[model samples]
Target: MPKLTSQQQYNIEQVAATMAIEDMPLTERAYKHLVQQATGEKTADQIAEEIKKEYQNG
Candidate 1:
């Protein structure tokens, strides 16, 4: 893994804190899972299309 700059680390910590306060466990889990899937793997458009398909089919 690459090192995060101090600003990046701060931003991540802020987002995590906000997520914790929101108490959105499922959303947080889904977001982390999607991020893992997305990292250097899928383009933004492809990910959006896949999500749209899932939402439509579900």
Candidate 2:
């Protein structure tokens, strides 16, 4: 949605490269969230509703 600065782009690339061979929890979390936003069909309201349900259930 927004443009990454050159340094930010390089940092992501570096994290991705490390993730290719091993587990990087924070990076993995960030990557999963990024991919979810990139491909998701749900709106922010929908996601928030889901979270609300989860919290209510728990």
Candidate 3:
């Protein structure tokens, strides 16, 4: 994965801090997972399909 700039990391930290307590962990995890998927390890279509599956399962 490409390295995030200091500014980008700061922004992520700020957003994570603002998230609701119950949602913070999941949101952070999903954000990191999606970033990984986006940066080339996984295709966009695959990510969409996974999100769809999650929604359907819920």
Candidate 4:
């Protein structure tokens, strides 16, 4: 994998430090697809909804 540039690292760190966990949502299609592959049996929307529900209930 390519190394992250200093600016990219800083930006990621800033977001990580300031962003609320609940505010994050599954917006990346590629990641949703990966979730499908990892789980072996679920649509992306299903996965996203399940995550949203779990986070909301916590």
TM-score winner among the candidates?
A: 3
Model 2: ten consecutive residues of lowest lDDT? 32-41
Best by lDDT: 3
Evaluated at residue 36, the lDDT of candidate 4 is 53
Model 2, 1-58: lDDT tens digits are 4455676566667767777768654455466444444445445566667768989999
What's each prediction's clash count?
0, 0, 0, 0
Tell me the spans in candidate 3 whose CA falls farther than 4 Å from its real position.
20-23, 33-49
Q: Could you give candidate 1's per-residue lDDT for residues 1-58 as a string of tens digits? A: 3355676556656666777889854465455544544354556677778779999999
Error of 2 at 7 (Å): 0.3
lDDT of 3 by residue, 1-58 (tens): 5676676667666655667455655465567755655455667687788889999999
The models' CA-based lDDT, in order, is 0.60, 0.60, 0.65, 0.56
lDDT of 4: 0.56
Best to worst by lDDT, what's the order?
A: 3, 1, 2, 4
Candidate 2 — which pairs collide?
Answer: none
User: Mind giving the per-residue lDDT tens digits that candidate 4 earns over 1-58?
Assistant: 2355676556555554554475664345534444454445666677778878989999
